[model samples]
Target: MTHAHAARPPRVAAGPAAREPAPGALPAWLAVLWAAALVATLAFAAVGGVHHAAVGVVTGAAFMALGAGMVVLLAPSDRVFVTRLFVGGFLARYVAALFITGAVMIAGLPGLEGGKDYLHWEASGWAVAEAWRSGSPTVHLTDKDPGYYYLVGAVFALTGRVAVAPLLLNGLFGAGAAVVAFFLALQVYDRRRAAVAGYLAAFLPTLLVWSGMVYKDVVLSFFVVACASAAIAISRQVSARSVCALGASLVPLFMIRPDTGVTIVGSAALLVGLTGRRRGSKLAALAVAGGVLLLFLAVLQGAGLGGKMDLLARFPNPLTSVAVARESWANEVGAGSSGLTRYLYGRNLLLAPHLLLAAMVLPFVLPLPGTTGGMMSIGTFLMPGQILWLLLLPGLLAGMAGAVRERAAAGIFLAGLVLAMALGVALAGYFSNPRYLVQGVPLMLVLSAAGIGYLRQRLLLYVSMLLCSVVVFCLYALARGS
Candidate 1:
């Protein structure tokens, strides 16, 4: 019998292959970094003498509560197994916000300030608040963001005009931004990488310094990141809910910075056209976005939203103005720069290598001499502890390379967002400062985290290079300071 039929292969399971377990939550090293940042910032605040110290304390408590509430609402459901991460993130960000509020309050005190720009901001913000309280038009005061003024005014009214009020509000925004960056990176990559990105977003000097200030830069940064996160969600799974989230996020952006809002939409359109899987729907999305932008611009112009400095007038024809503005700024501030900064501020495209170098490095390493004006608003040092950012550069480059290779939709969005910012900065001379690029800092952190993940195999090499970069930056800073 016959047979010696070969024993049938053990019945193969008919179900899908067993999926790999997801990565663990934020790493212990990241927790260490966050704690260090908190201690350092608090020390700085204590030594700096927190102005309105009592107010800062009260505001910090409020922000801590806000941070805790946010964790409950926004912590990712998929990471239920690592639920302690929610607690860690909320605590880290909450403490960071408290210290930041104290520092900003101390630095932003009305009489002891250093920058006219900050003074202007404070006065304008107070006036806006008063006007809102008394029901008057702030249109004549300035052509800047109404949303910021409204918010600042509301906070001032609530807190009885304490300078800490705005600082506290901004602190909350910064903390919320860290949370958003965490989830956003989680969507793009895995948990460990997400932790890296979130840690950087939460503690990065760029965000901490800018977001702690009284300026609108941090608010713009938050909205930009929010819009990017919403866009990423939509890209992963397009739905009415995602679209509405995107639209809702953009509304505040439009109110605060219309040009940036346009740039975001334009970038989003490019992203969908390049990377969207659906052929027909992609085209339709592009058309609709374009139409909406054009209509919005027309409506803004019709409503005289731009006043004398009409944004629409500069559109579709900004190069000439850009050149003029670049020349003027170079004459004003491009004196000692030797590398990309000199060339870029000089608006010299013939030195494209310098442009590339500067574009890649300036966001992290751009130095401000101690004697430089506008120290109060910008800070005594541009990105203090600047050497640390070197750790992320390799990751950023590696991530960008991998993204291009993969033809990832997230990569397209990142490229578009960066390009739009670069172009916008070039086009608007007044907006040419590095601070204007703060909006994209969250994405930059995301890319850097991706870079870390990609280079995990070459861990030693990456660490060595990172250390060398930090050493070099320190040596350079010392030499310059000396």
Candidate 2:
């Protein structure tokens, strides 16, 4: 017999409240967050020894440009609040980039003592930009993901080699991600709850820090979330807008991170098939989804990964093969986090077999390792969200439970993306570096946001427990130091 589902709540009629939030909420939030980011950017420039007088000017101008784009993408939704979300989220990331720049350049950040990929990308990008400007031969990097460098070079060329310009572009994408989170949450939940999720997407530490960095974090995450969101919309209705959105999102996504792109597309294909209204519509939607996959595979082959893909297929178990590869790569991350990784994965095969179960629970436990900050590493910069993650874990669980009870497809779609990425990271034993987990942070924040409404009294209880945990951790750190 089919199980009973909880009755869904009554939908409210579209009104001014739904169309526009409290008049100045977004604007106020944007003003404060942008000011913070600007202050930090200038401080970082001065402290980090940048001689460019235009740094502050450039930062402000970029925020303005990003704000303009945000309005175009989100304000058109009849929700001026969404445009505000773009500002909050973009500035959060903007502040994050400057913090990282300062830490790496000034504080002798213990975390990234070994290597700083963003600095490398910035330097290389500047070189490429200069070559292009002077009519010199182009520089091509063969060792790494050259696509990101080329993008950085293009931005630097246009802006005359301004530092962190690519990061500003990434912040723009991060802002778009925030807007997408708002709309998706609104679709699945309600306007009020969606607004909460949207703002959470803006202020969450991991979301800000990773998106703020000049690396591939925000761009990679945006496409994945955008693809997943489009996939969910397709599940609701196979429309030209949703189909085109899915294709546009999944194409660049594949070029950026192939596995995550597959997870998103695969999830979409499954979702569309399961939820389509009719046999004809289901077939058509599935066909379009398959077309995107085929196009991505062709691109992969052109990029010289066809043989690797075929070899991956030849594996008796692809997950195991991928895991071994990731484990090897994780070793490169260094010895400090090796203990943490082993503690999570273990020598025994206990964690890997329970992929779905483990993926759902693993992200919460990540904050445990470096909470004391005794051994700083690259993970430390991303670790600002650790305690926040702890604080939100209960709500995340509560939100997931609520979604299950209500049978919310959007929640399932979001939960799917988050868990899929976590599972892949877990299987690969890539626990040492938390950046791999950034792909899921925005969606996790959405879940936590929804859970906030569900936790009426328990919220205070959770906060008290969090404070207790912090006190205990502090005591332990003091004891060790003494």
Candidate 3:
């Protein structure tokens, strides 16, 4: 509704820039995503049994109803494509979640015992839910990501006592994230790019796979994106409504991922403070943004949360992280493919700041998976998503230049987001966990969408650099005997 900071062509139109896309705009790639999930589900059914999958589908459908119901009630009347994208996003995650747990368990994939963090969250939430239902105190569960377990527990209190309930909710949240992403992209980019971003946000293999499983990251990601969307709105208009929306979305996030919550708050404040058209109005908006930031920090600190803010000003400092300089280096390095379990294994900071370099090259990665003997001996259920990441790589690089540019207010906020996430990853060394990348996926997709057209121009150059990065990194690993 606000065009104050909107980017546009020289030519103008009276209608909304993000008009309805062509018929069948949701596209067949979404179908391919579902098909991949289906195959994985089938694999689980054949290997494990149908019982787990049946429960998953039933449970997923229930969660889908709740999440989708809210969307339908609140969604703008004119955006049919948003609704379609929502369905595609929800179904992809729901179907993927249906049997993914069993598939991981039986196949002995990476993080097999706990299916990474999903089973941990599910089991813990189930216990917490039972404890709450029985009116007992002291539901002993993980302190890490306590928000996820409690939320999952709350859902179980109202639904069937299904173990797969969290997965279903994950599917729903994943869809919510896509919808949020659609609006975020529309902030500065055109309608067509927004649509591409919407679908990519929904069906990108990493996003769908992570959300399909029961874990904190996907849930946290939805809230993070929601906060960012609200922040962008605030940056453009500084409305009472937008500020409240940001707060509503941000409170739950302190426990989900404190670093991200704090970063967005600070970033939003910076944007509001900097982008005022009139000094008088800008001062008022800055006061509001600043007031919220100070109040939130005080409240969150008092609640024994936001400890991540203490780490905020330290190494991999968000203030200087991923400036255009590093982005240019990333454009040259092209080395996000390898999970940085031991990047710079034996090297010192003089040669390369491993995590910092890893941080700059954003897409996402996984620890090279095999039998623990060699990288060649591979047998994991995550192949599809990793393969998908490879395919998305070029678009990611192509989009790099856009973020680093001096862009609109909405665009600057987005660039700040990616920079903050890169810093978060560097400091946390959450190298092996793809979940850590959840908050950045929409930006990556939006960037990818924006860059897709220009990719052919440097197709050969990027591919060769990527191959070189891989080969050189592998040789380094061999030399170190890792």
Q: Tell me each candidate's TM-score.
A: 0.74, 0.76, 0.74
- lDDT for 333 (candidate 2): 32
Residues 193-309, model 3: lDDT tens digits: 777788888887777667656667788778888888887787677789888989999888987776677667777677666765443575757655784675445333322232455
Local distance difference test values of all predictions, in order: 0.62, 0.64, 0.63
TM-score of 3: 0.74
Where model 3 places Cα greater than 4 Å from the true spot, the runs are 1-55, 105-118, 139-145, 159-161, 278-352, 371-379, 456-481
In the range 321-356, model 2's lDDT, one tens digit per residue, is: 445544554453323433544455445444344455
Q: Which residue pairs in candidate 1 collide?
A: none
Error of 3 at 379 (Å): 7.6
Q: Candidate 2 clashing pairs? A: 111-377, 111-378
Q: What is the lDDT of residue 149 in candidate 2?
A: 69
In model 2, where is the ten-residue run with the lowest total lDDT? Answer: 299-308
Residue lDDT tens for model 1, 1-482: 22345655555665212332325645564468567655745664575445444555566567667665667665657344223343344344444445554545565544222356656666777887788788898897655667777777777776666655676677676666666777788887888788777767776766666555567777777778888888777666688977987898899988877777776776665555445566368575775568457534533432234432376665654455445555654654455434544655555654344344335544555455453445443435444635456767778767787788887778657755665564444334322256667777778888888888888899987887677666755543553344
Candidates 1 and 2: which is better by TM-score? 2
In model 1, the runs with Cα more than 4 Å from the true position are 1-51, 76-114, 280-282, 285-309, 314-319, 338-358, 369-383, 426-432, 459-482
Question: Quick one: best lDDT, which candidate?
Answer: 2
Leading candidate by TM-score: 2
